[model samples]
Target: MDIHFYKISISGIVQGVGFRPFVYNLAYKHNCIGEVYNDADGVLIKLGCKDIEVFLDELQALAPPLAKITKITQETIEPFERSDFVIRQSHDANSSTTILSPDIAMCDACKKELFDPTSKRYKYPFINCTHCGVRYSIIKNLPYDRINTAMGVFMMCDACKKEYEDPTSRMFHAQPIGCNDCGVKTFLHVNTTTIQKDTLYHTAELLKEGKLGAIKAVGGFHLVCDATDENTVQKLRQNKHRPTKPLAILVKDFAMAKKYGVFSEKEKEVLLSKEAPIVLVKKNRSDLASAIAPGIDKVGIMVASNPLHLLLFEYIDTPLVATSANLSGEPIITTKEDIEQKLPFVDFILDYNREIINAIDDSVVQVVDEKLCILRLARGYAPLHLKLPKKIDEKVLALGANQKASVAIAFEDNLILSPYIADLDTIESIEHFQSMIANFKRFYNFDFDVVLHDSHPAYESTKIAQTFDTKKVAITHHKAHLLSVMTEPSECVSFVFDGTGLGEDGELWGGEVFVAKERKYHFKPLVLLGGEKAIKECYRVALSKLFEVYPLDEVMELELDVVKRYKSKIPLLYHLFQSKKNLKTSSVGRLFDMVASIVGVLHEQTYEGEAGLRTEALVGTLTREKRFEFTIQEGVIDIAFDFFASDFVERFYATLCSIVITLAKQEEKKVLFSGGVWQNKTLLEFVISELQKENIPYTFNTIVPINDSGISVGQIMEYING
Candidate 1:
């Protein structure tokens, strides 16, 4: 048989994920002689084969489990003599489209070897193999090799070296391959004492005593304590300065998780998957300390996604409150110095010597309408790659909204989103955002043709995009949200609701309904008093709406108890609304804030979406469905609030659903829900149920976050289409 010479290139999350080892084994099995190597672009394979079709089919069918092949290319090459298949060293040839894989949870095979006494990696804190281990978090650069990773410092031992060299061994060419003799070491610090011996065991003992410990995991440090200990949980909250925000806990397994939180079969599958994200589940038992989640009925829970955490369960039987080890509103702690400096209140610190190049936080998800929706995308779930429905000619960079920020890069028909970045208000978070953008540019090695940003000129991200030496496109914030989840180039009636975004008409838009066919708007503009300061004070928003339809004296005469309670602020708010001095906003989020303040649930916004979240939580208790009087005349919704009672919350949601369905019927188009407001479970459920009852087709974001974190994706989509 005559041999054929071929060169193949495979792209996507193929590096640092056993792709080379997989290619080496496949070549030997298929009786082909060639060399496989890694380069700046992706995997490069040169092969000499008699029947190339069979070889290519098998390789595609049996790629490594961790490898995600986004694109594959093959071409005829000049013949070269080679005796046998071999793995070659990685090279930095040129700008590459190859992207690093997100850090994956430890596979069961590695977990088994870690626990077996006969295995060389038994009881090893940093035990990892070819199939699973750290990837993006530890990687410093591309052509992902040991030298480009934090693990480069830990040279392999003789036993590991042998396995890494053997073609038949699972760890052949595994960059992170290591054994107990030559792996990262752990240390335990308790108060002023530092102990190198029995660190894991002693840390477990401390947790059992209701003491909090900062434990280093794959991404960053996590503050851990016994979840059953009320005082210990409370102490963690007080020290972290996180007063009422719910804490995430880590259980040993799915069965234990089910015992505390209700889980569906799909949810159980997600929890057991390699991603192992913190899943928000409804609480089934109240026996565990209520301080873990406080008044919230839903609790965020996760399982051990790494070896050290699984081993910790051996000494400690109960669940642990595993929250990010940083002060509230700060980035996650990665360096030991940060843990010591920022979180000195912890009883002990359990850490390893391995460096974390990218400090990622745990991803958080919730099941909405029986489908998983990402709340915060990071760790195993970020650097999200998606193939667009249509191809683009030039490369583009999209900067997301200011809050819950994320950056996206678009080239050809693909869009890759960076891991979720914090709000851009702080200096640290802004630096992190810029660093992520720089990293994406370096990794993809592309000259961006254009940069896309929110139309809000005041946004920091918008300002940053303007500084880039490329053509810039300003997309309306709500329009970007509508396009974020549009998988196809189709028109539909969309509802976009969030805290605030600059509208095309130069108004602050929070809640909006538009027909994509003509971009017609059907929204009631609610004037906001006090400009930017109005966001923090909900009473101003409530009084602003009251002043819109009533005389100043009549507004003062309203019988609402909350208005009476904060009677002093009404005079100033009324004057601001009358003069139109406080910026005019048509924001639905402010309406929620107004209602939240009116009911006396949340008066001031200490954090983003606080009023909306607290108001939605009340929906769980009130089963009564009532419709508040809302009138729609000449494309505006007018609600005359007669009372500020508990029933009004349910009424507002019900009325909103009715109006959306009515508009969808009139337009004769499917409905699309996008924005942060849909993140509210109560409002989402009501809207979904109403749509289903009317048999109206609707679509929501499943691949990306419904909030502004996904705005970058929409920005790219609109730019490409334009």
Candidate 2:
């Protein structure tokens, strides 16, 4: 019989996801004789088979669930003598091109074993197999193996070692394979006392008593408490200094999740996915404390994704308020010491001995217009890798905008993005950003040829870019937002609207329409009377808008709460508006703030997107829709409208939709939507419905975020197009 020898190279997320064992079994099934192993680039196979094409077809068709095969190539080679198909040790090279798998949720098999009394791993907090376990967060270096991960320090017991070596066992070659006999131990710390025995039981008891505890999770730490306890939830808010921002809840399973929130089919699928991100859904139960989301009708919900979390749920019945353990605008805390020192309100600490090399927060997503929209990309959805349309000659790094900071690195047709780093507003957040950059460099053994940053000169990311010892290029912020959603270099009309970004003309431009790469139109500029203070106190923007069309006495005569409350400061605010010395902005996000204040939804914002969220909530409460007049002339759009109408919020949204439709009609091209403002579901749905009715094509971000967290990816896209 004739034999064929072929060398196969496969790349993409093929490591630490049970790819090697799958390949080993596939080789035997195909009657092939050779070996499979991992290398720097990806999986490599040397096969001697009768029909290589048939084997290749089955390989792609029956690959593991978590494996993502991007590229596969085969080359004929000299036939070699091989007795049997086997798995070999990983081969490390100078540099790596393989994509790292994001951390995956616990598999059904592991969960089953965790609850089985007969199983050795029953009630074990760190049980994992090759099918599902920690990946990115525990990994320290490439060519993924036990020695290169946080699990290397733990020696496997006799039973675990036997299972690790057995090809038929699910734990075969699992990097994080461990059992209670020889793995990390959990401990509960309460008021200078350490409780080592029955820690999970004690932790659950404390949480049931409405005690706030910091629990170590797969990526970082979570400040956990009973979600139904209003007093505990309020205490968490005061202690964390996160006043009115919504907190996410962790449920035991889909049944428990359904009790608190109404999930669509698509939302349910994403919630149960391996990524296991927090999904925003309609609040269904009033039993949950009102303080959980206060004023917002939607609640963020996620299922327990890891073994430790699942085990905790076995003892606790109530949903747990699982907010990241960190200061406001800071990275998630990863160390036990840090959690104990920083979060003084934590009544106890549920911790383990395992080290967390990378600290990632939980990713957030929501279903918009029957499609998935990413809000915060981290944990199970990061260390994201995208294949470039074409290879680039130089290695590049993109430092994203300041608010929702993230970094991206592009090299050799591969673009890798870091997990969502918190806003670079504090010293700790800046340090976290720098550490993530350093981690990426070390992971890929990378040296950048150039770095890209926002045009905003004073942005912390821009300042850090100047410190980098490499060539730097500044791209306008709005343009970067536009390019992030564009798949190819084509002429299209893009509407980039957000709260703030530096324009090419050195003004704060957020409400902008661009044809191709050139800005074609913008909203009429509105003066921010107190600069940054206007953002925190949204009523100032409302007053400024009112002063734009009305005289001081006329504005004062209007019976508005803003005017009644700030009656004394109105004259000075009007003077600042007339002087125009304050920063000028064309921001639709500020428009939301203005409308929200006028409707008495909120006069001040405690969170980043509070005004927008409250305004969006009002869209559902409107009894009727009315027309609000607007004008487009001289490359500017005027949004001055009557603020006294009962349905002003509804009319304002309708007018914005009309503006987009009008622009699309004029441009006669596909429309691309981006920026943080698109996260407002009501407005985006309105525009989408109108565009579809008019038979106008439109596109938006699905893979990455539409917010500033995706700015780094957009910056790279801009550079590539240029």
- Candidate of highest TM-score: 2
Indicate the TM-score of model 1.
0.95
- For model 1, how does the per-residue alpha-carbon lDDT over 263-353 read when each residue is reduced to its tens digit? 9888888888788899988888987888887655688999988988988998888989999888877778898898888888988999898
Estimate the overall C-alpha local distance difference test score of candidate 2.
Answer: 0.90
- Alpha-carbon TM-score of each model against the true structure: 0.95, 0.98
Q: Weakest 10 consecutive residues, lDDT, candidate 1?
A: 620-629
Estimate every model's Cα lDDT from 0 to 1.
0.84, 0.90
Backbone clashes in model 2, listed as residue pairs: none
lDDT by residue for model 2 (611-718), tens: 889977777442213558778998899976888888778888888888888999999989888999999888888889888989999888877899998899989989
How far in Å is the alpha carbon of 546 misplaced in model 1? 3.1
